[model samples]
Target: MFYPLRERISTWTTSQQTAEEETELIQRKRIQDLPLLRAAKENDIHLLKQLLEDKNCDPFQRGAVGETALHVAVQHENLEAAEILLDEAPQLINQPMTSDLYQGEHILTFAACVGDIEIVKILLDHGANLHAKDSWGNTILHILVLQPSKSLLCQMLDFLLSKDGGKTLIDIPNARGLTPLKMAASEGNVTMFQHLIQKKRKIQWTYGPAATMMYDISECDSMEDHKSVLELIATSSKSQAHKILNVPPVKELLQKKWQNVGRPYTWFLTAVYILYMICVSLCCAHRPLKPREDNVTNQRDITIYVQKTLKEAYLSGDDRLRLVGEIISVVGAFILLLSELSQAYIFGLKYFISHNFWRDPFNIIRICYSCMILVILGMRLTDADGEVVPMSAALVLGWCYIMYFARGFQMLGPFTIIIRKMAASDLLKFCWLMAVVVCGYSLALYVTFQTVDPQALGAFYSYTMTLISTYCLFSNLLNGPANYTIDNPAMYSPLYSSFCVIAFLLMFNLLIAMMGDTQSAMAKKKEELWKAEISGATVKMEQTFPKSHWFCSESSGNDFKETRYISLEEKKWHPFHLEEASGSSSDDESDEDVPPQNSQERNPNLDPYQEIREDITDRAEDRGNVDHNDNEIWEEELFEF
Candidate 1:
C-alpha cells in the first residue's frame, strides 16, 4: 500500500508540472502581445496613439486570444481605441482572429455581437468587409441575429438596410444552410422575422413574379426545421406570414406539393374518418329495440317478448354488424388519437392545444363524438342498455365532423373559417348575455308565479317556460306564452311577454351586429385566411409522412435556382391559348414545380458580366421606404441570444 501511494504521488507531480508549463506559455504570449494590444484592452487611448505613432508599433499584431489591437478595442468596447487602431492600420478592420475559439472573426463580427452601432459604422467606414464569416461560417448579419437586445438589433438592421447589398445578405445562408429569415423562424423569433420582412417588403413585391434581383425563398435543411418554419408561418398573425405565403413561387410550390403528397394523405384520412362515422352510425342505429308495455300482459307474453328481443339484439345479422363496427370505430379513434399525440410531442403541448386545435369546430366535434363512443363502449361492455342519450349525441357530432373535409376547398374554407370565428366569438358572447337575461327573468317569474300558486308551481317550471318563450321570441312567435299552462295565465302572461320583448330585442340586435362585424372582418381577410388554412392543412399532412421522403439533401447538378421561376411578367387571362402547351417538354415543366436544393444558381442565357453589373446597379438604389407598420403588431418577446 505504501509503494502504490508513492507511485500516485509521482504521477501527480508530473501532471502539476505540465499544467504549470501551459500556464507559463500563455503568460509569455500575453507579454509578447503587450503594449499596443494591452493599451487598447485597457482603454489607454493616449498610450495606444503614442505606441502607434512614436514607436511605430504594429497595431495589426494579435494577442494570446488571437485578437489584434482593433479586435481587443472592440471586445473591450473602447470606441476611441478602435478608431485610433483603424486609422493607423486600416487592414486590421477585417483581420480575423487566428486563435481556435474565434478564428475567422473580424472586428465587424465583434462590433455586431457587442451591439455597438458606432463601432459597426466606424469599421464599415474603414473598409471592413460586412460579409466576413466567423469560424462557424456565420456572417455579420447572423452574428447580429444572435444579439439579445432588440433596440440594438433594430438599429443594426436599419443601418444595414441603409447600406448597399444589405437585402441580399438576408438571403445568404451560412454553413448550416440557415438564412437569417429561416434562422429566425427556426428559433421562433417572431420579431426578427417581422423586422426582416419589413425590410424585405420594400423590395419584394408580392403580387409580381418572384424577382430574383430582390427576394428569394429559403429552403429548410431538415424535416424538423421544415416543420418548425411551417409552424411559425401557420400560427403567426403577422402580415409578413401572409406576404410570404402569397409569394407566387411559394404558392406554386405549395400547390405542387399538395397535389403530389398532401392530397393522397388527406384522402386516406378522409376515408378512415368517413368509415369511422359510418361505423358509429351503425352501432347507434342497430341497438336493441325496447319491448312494448301493452304486449307484455302475462308471464307467457313477457317471456315471448324477452326471447324475441334477445334474438334481435344479440343474434341477428345487424347486431353482428354493430359489434364489428364498434371494433372498427375504436381502432379508428385510436389511430387518430395517436396522430394527435405525435403532433403534440412534435410542436409542444401548449401549441398543440391552444393555437388552432381547440378553436377548430371540427376538432371539437370529433372530440365530443369520440368521448361519447368511449362511454357507449364502456356501458355496452357492462351489458347495460342505457346508451341511448350518448349514442344520439355522438351520432349528431359524428355527422357534424364532416366540416373538417371542407377546409380543402377554397370556397368552403373561407366560409368555414368565418363560421368558426363567429361561433367562437360572436355566438359565445351572445349566449353568455342571453344566459344572464334568461336567469334574471326566470327568477322574477318564479317569484311572481310561486306567490300565486306555491304548491302548483314546480321549481324548474318557470325556468322552462322562460327559456321556451325566449326561444319562441327569437323565432318571431309573439304569442308563444299563451300555450303555456299556469296557475294564473294573466299574472304569468304579462311578465313573460315583457321578458320576451325586452330580451329578444336586446340580445338579437346585439348578436346581429356582432355577427355582421365578424363577417365583415373575415370577408376583408378572406384571401389571407384561406391561404393560411391551406398552408396549415399542407403542413399537417406533411407531418404524417416518413422522414425518408423529405427533401433534406442538396441537389447534385446546377439546375435553375430558387423555389420556382415564373416569367418576369404576370400572364394575362385570355379565352384562347397564347402559346402551345407542351406535354412532353420535361425541361420547361421541371423548372415550374421543382425547387433547387442550392439557393444560388446562374441563368444560362444571361451573360455573367451583364448580370453582375445589373446586380451592382440594383444594390445601389436607396432602400429607405421600408414598411414599419408591423412593429406594433408583432410581440416584443423575441429570441434569446
Candidate 2:
C-alpha cells in the first residue's frame, strides 16, 4: 500500500534506541511475561530462577504501571524475591517508580510505607537514604502516622527518629503545607494526637494559631471524634483559642443559628400532609366487601360472580379519591426524602450520622414519618384495596410529624423535652414490663377462651385484640371496648378485671411513680434542660434550610484559605512532658517520660487494658438492649434513616 506522508518529528520522540534496549522494551510490552512477574511477586524461587537465567528477559523492566519486578516483590511483601533482586542489582534501590501511586518512590519508601520491617532493615543496611522525599513530601514518619496498626507505624517512627537524633522529619511540611503533627490531628487518633503534642509542645504561642491541625472537623464520624480534634486544638495548643480558630473558618458551620421561618415552614408541611390524609380518610370510609380476600370460596357460582362484581365496582369506582391522595402523599414524601438527603450531604455524611440523623430526636421522628408514607406507597403499589393498615399508618404519621413542630416551637419544646426525658428514662422500662405482662396474659386467655367461648374469643387474634384493647384503657385511648367484656361476661369478665388490676392498678401506677421520680429529678436540672432545649430549637430552625444558598455556600466562613504557617523547627524547640492525670496508676507514671510511640503494645495484665476491653464488651451488650441507663443505646435507635 502507498502510505500518505505523515509528520516525522524524531527530535520529539526517542527514535535512537540501541538493539539491546529495543529488545528489552519489546519484552516489557508483552503480556505473556505476566506469569514471570507473578512468579517473582509470589517469591517462587524455582520459577524466578528460571526466568532470571534467560538473558533476553529484562528482570528490571517496567510494567504498564511503571513498576519493575523488584517493585512488585516489595509491594507484595515478597521478601525472598526482593533479596534476590537486591543481590543481583543493588542500584535498583534508588530507582523511582513512574506509577501515580508510587511516583518517584524509591525501594525504602515503599518498604517503610507497607511497614515491612525486614525489607526496610535490608534496604537501610544497604545505605538507602532516609532523607529522600517522595511525591507527597512524606518521610518514614509521615507515612506511618495514620496507619490503623499503630505498632508498626510507631516502631518505624521511633527507629527513624533515633537514627536522625534531631527529628527534622517531624516538622517537615508536605505540598499541602501539612506537617506530620497537623495531619495526625485531622485523623482523630487520640493516642497519636497526644503523642505528637507531647513531642512538639515546647514551641511557643508566638507561632500563631494552628488552624490546619483540625481542618477535618466537618467530616468527623463521632462526637468523641469531634471532641478529640477540639481537645488537641483548644486544650493542647499553646496558642490562644481565638487565634487558633482563625484557620478553618468552621465556627459558623459548627454553630446552627435559629431562623424564625422554620415554624411557618413546618406548618406548611403539616397542611399539605393533612390534606393528602383527608383524601385517604374518605377512601377508607368505604371498603370492598370482600377485602383481604387471600383465601375465599362460595357454594353458588352466580352468588360468587355477583359478590366479585360488587366488590370490584366499589373498589374501582370509589377508590379513585384514595389513589389521588396516595399519589400526592408519595410526591410529598419524595420531596421530604430528597430534602433530607441534600441536607445530609451538605452537612457532611459523618456529621449528619453523628448529630442530625442519630442524635436529634425530631430528626428521627421526621425520618420515621417519611418511612410510614413510603410503606403506604408500597402497599398501594401492591394494589391493597384495604382500609386497616393504611388508616393505621396515617394516624401514626399524623402524631409522629408533630415531633417536628414539637421541637421547633419555644413553648412546646419544654413539654417535648419532659416527654423525651421521661421516654429516655421511665417510659422505656415501663414499656418493656407492659409488653411482657401483656404477652403472658394474652397466651393464657387464648387457651382459656378457646375452651369456654370458641366463637367470640376462639381465634388467637381475638384474645390479642381484647388484651390490647384492655391495655389501651390504661392510656385512655380506649375506655370500654373489650369486645366481649360485657356481652360474654363469663369469658371476658375475669380477663378484663385481672388486666385492669395488673396493668392499671399496679403497672400503670408504677409507671406514674417512675415518671414522677424522673420529673422531680429533671426539675432539679430545669435550667440545664432549658439550655439544651434552646440549643435544640435553634438546630431545628437552622435545619429548615434557607430560601437561598448564599449564606451557607457563598459565605467566607464556609471554607479555609490556602495559607501555610511557619513550623517551630526554625527556632529548634524540643518537646517536653505534658502534665499527667492525677492519681495516675503506677504503670502510667512509670511510662510518663517514655513517649507512647516507644511502646509497641499495652501491657495486657494492666487494669487499663482490661478496663478498655470490658468497656467495649459492655457497650456492645447495652447496644443490643433498648434501655439506656448508662450506655449510649440511643446511637442504635435509628435502625434505618
Best-matching candidate per TM-score: 1
TM-score of each: 0.58, 0.38
Q: Show model 1 residue runs off by greater than 4 Å.
A: 1-119, 124-179, 183-225, 228-231, 293-312, 452-479, 483-494, 547-641
Clashes of 2: 0
Q: Scored by CA lDDT, what does every candidate get?
A: 0.64, 0.55
Q: What would the per-residue lDDT of candidate 2 be over residues 301-370, giving only the tens digit for each residue?
A: 3322111232353356455655565667667667767777886888788888765665445566556656
Clashing residue pairs in candidate 1 (N, C-alpha, C atoms within 3 angstroms): none
Error of 1 at 345 (Å): 3.4
Model 1 lDDT per residue over 245-275, tens place: 5554445546555555555666666787787
Instruction: Give the worst 10-residue stretch by lDDT in candidate 2.
Output: 203-212
Model 1 lDDT at residue 352: 73
Clashing residue pair totals per candidate (backbone < 3 A): 0, 0
